[model samples]
Target: MTAFTRGFRLHLADGQVLDGAEFPSGRAALVDDPEFGFVTGAVSVEELLLGYHGARIEWDDEALLEGKPRPTADSITSDQLDALLLKAARADSTWATALREAATVADGGRENDCGCGGCDTCAQHRIGLELRRRADERDGGRP
Candidate 1:
């Protein structure tokens, strides 16, 4: 069995100590214990730390996972982009439809002449172009 590294220590008000590690997503993952089995899902490490008031926190800088590069748009895969678009569609159908249409046009090498960046059409076109660019990169320069 692999040994778990203690990256941080949380001293709770009830005289209990918890060991946790910082994930690459900036969230804290508490070690598995009898009461809590590998707790996580906090929005961020700060939020998790802030939740327990009147608690002392200890950090092991060497053991903590920090300074990890976050995933950029270029690093996303086409399937991931499609999943995001699908999620957007589920949230806002009209907006997602417009974006899909704009992306289709962009994929066809069509350009929008609208100079106003704030306009809905222009914004959609820009997002669509970016999506196409990422997709092309993922496809090894093939549109």
Candidate 2:
């Protein structure tokens, strides 16, 4: 059996506490996954923390699983776990996609409304108003 060298505990807003053991092997297994994060918007420890908080706010406190306390939004899900693993597994693909996107936006062009500090297309600028209009519609005409 493995002995824990450190124990990490997170006190969730819903009054549930998440506890996990930190072993050398576990530390060695920790890694980052981007597509998992991009696809789900949950790629980092902080992102996971925020997701747990969201879940905590969404679920009832009395829920339970297999006699153990169920996770609120504050609890990490198997989906998130799988996302992490998937991100790790598809790291190369994600990198390639990112590179391709970067190349498409090639630097030294111009600037967009948000000023991403990159070049922009005159066509893009001319159509910017229409794009914003559509965005406004999508946002329900909020400012």
Candidate 3:
């Protein structure tokens, strides 16, 4: 059996501890954590740590089967999902549609909200009622 190395571990807000591992999109055999670590994705290690603290998502480091991505907001695209749907739509449409819809609901709430860093309705401010409403709506009531 293949052995794995240990890497950065995160203590999640929900009392779950996740370890970082690396894999090539999981089509091959499963590997232990520490091979790829969490640095292989667009989201940084700090972002994953913060997500753990913020309770937005949860993950683990157990050897994953093939096809399990690095697990991040930008890991996959709606188009890729659409393609998969096109291929598998006939299998079951209800759960697949809901998965696509719910999984994609957080797309617009990316890190581009503060593009200018000078607007009155800046990402930080949200002081006024309108700004707060907009921000809340934009995040899908997540925050």
The TM-score-based order of candidates, best leading, equals 1, 2, 3
Q: What tens digits encode model 2's per-residue C-alpha lDDT throughout 18-131?
A: 543334343311112333532222333344456555333221212223223333355758975575556554664555445434433542223244354332544444344444
When superposed on Cα atoms, how far off is each prediction in RMSD? 14.6, 16.9, 16.5
Among all windows of 10 consecutive residues in model 3, the one with the lowest summed lDDT is 23-32
Write model 3 residue lDDT over 1-143, tens digit each, in one string: 11322244455566655546333332121122345643334234444444344542223423331234333445557765675556454444444444344433433333334355654555333333334344444444533
In order of appearance, the predictions have TM-scores of 0.34, 0.23, 0.20
Candidate number with greatest TM-score: 1
lDDT, candidate 1, 1-143, per-residue tens: 11333267888888889887766556667653647576754756678877788877776642222332223445746765676566654555444445556677754434454445554557656767776665555444655
Clash pairs, candidate 1, are: none
Candidate 2 stretches greater than 4 Å from native: 1-7, 12-87, 107-143
Candidate 2 local lDDT, residue 143 = 25
The lDDT, on a scale of 0 to 1, for candidate 1 is 0.59
The segments of candidate 3 whose C-alpha lies over 4 angstroms from its true place after superposition are: 1-6, 21-40, 54-143
lDDT: the better of candidates 1 and 2: 1
Candidate 1, which ten residues in sequence have the lowest lDDT sum?
Answer: 62-71
lDDT of each: 0.59, 0.41, 0.40
